[model samples]
Target: MNHPIAQRVPGRRPAAARRPGRRPAPRPAARRLAPLALLCALASLATGCGIRATSVPVDAGAAPSRVGCVLPEDRERPDGDGADSIVRLYLVCGSRVSPVEREVRMPDGRSATERLPVARELLEELQRQPGAMEDTAGFETAVPNDLKVSGSRDGDPDEALRLNRSLDALPPFALAQLVCTLADTAAADADEGVVLGGPADDEAAGPLRRYECDTALRTHPEAAETAGTDV
Candidate 1:
């Protein structure tokens, strides 16, 4: 019995020499969420470090509407001589344009037929050399004293007035003065604008063209420079 007692097993490790059990693998959802958790942590760190993004205020709708500057209303004097009505005349003052009030004796009639005479008188006033007061105030007019206006039946729309010279012959500033003056008078008659043609005596002249006095033309006479030779 002692002889056959025991033969030690060769090439076998002891129980204490065996490897320890391994930990379980992480779940699929947890593995997928790791990157997301890392991103959230980075964002929080950035915020904590006081980093900020830039932003701009934007106007998301149509722009605000603009209203043009208007001339003062005319003053009415019913009993002050024959010159009882006051009208605004656009005149050049230094580098800018402005309205100058003038008293004109309007005829008793309130018909459109009276517009032509009133327009003529206004033109005369414009052509007259700036008065002492106007000269002192740095006001001036570009209209020529010899320039004349007449009525025409040229069949052009709203074109009832004819100039003494070709529209192209007049300087832009001069033309603006004439156009605005006539337009102001015609407006009183409910006319949209003053339609003007070249000299009535010139048979080769072109047909009439309509002109209006807008805020741009009144406040900025230099705007007429690009109106072309036909204006």
Candidate 2:
């Protein structure tokens, strides 16, 4: 389901969970941090995933190339100090199931936090999965062995998709599709758990909505020329 964060970047929480927005200003860390920095830089592009319109034709005029932004609402918990804990999951390009990990520290040494990573190839599979539809219940799996989703002292949805080592042998989209299937099933299960545990004991589907802002896709000369033309 599309949430507020889908508009901005991947692997991120929603915006309200982030520091207030600043003009697309240049921040100090904007540069020098190549490699992984590309994503982080892009993350600063917009507060949330901007907007999405219906998928008309592949020729859908005016549609932006990217959809979904990671929201900042859920961030790595600050250096403990009595703050809520934070956990991050990364989808690497082409590694095994074991993703790199990290800890952001907790106020009380009693608890522990963990970050997960995955391969980029895996994430690409997440993008390609046909589940882009409204309510698909099935799932897909890629490299299930090399990856690990071990829980923390207190579990916080610690899951990441990344690539580092292991299977240089890529699976057909079938593999990625499998991972998608499992994740989806897990998400639905989580939703059910939330409702069951909610104070009101009420079950509510998460809010989902969309908007269209970019005119470039539809405004492009080729798209314009095709508009109102015979299918």
Model 1 lowest lDDT segment of ten: 66-75
Model 2 regions lying over 4 Å from their true place: 1-62, 72-85, 92-166, 170-231
Residue 85 error, candidate 1, Å: 1.9
Task: State which candidate has the highest TM-score.
Answer: 1
lDDT of 2 by residue, 1-231 (tens): 756744756788676787675567665673645755666557656743343645775764886543222223444533534453342222222221211112333233311121222223223334432322211212223334543222212222323222222112234232322232223222212321110011111123111111111232112312211221110
Off by over 4 Å in 1: 1-83, 157-159, 187-191, 225-231
lDDT of 2: 0.29
| TM-scores, each model vs. reference | 0.57, 0.17
Question: 1-231 in candidate 1: lDDT tens per residue?
Answer: 357745556888766676779577767998899998877768877574344544877768998753322332443423445656776676777555566677776655545777667778778878877665556566788888898887765454343677888877776678777777766564232555666678877877775666667877776777665442232
TM-score, model 1 to reference: 0.57
Model 2 RMSD vs true structure: 36.6
lDDT scores in order: 0.66, 0.29
RMSD of 1: 12.8
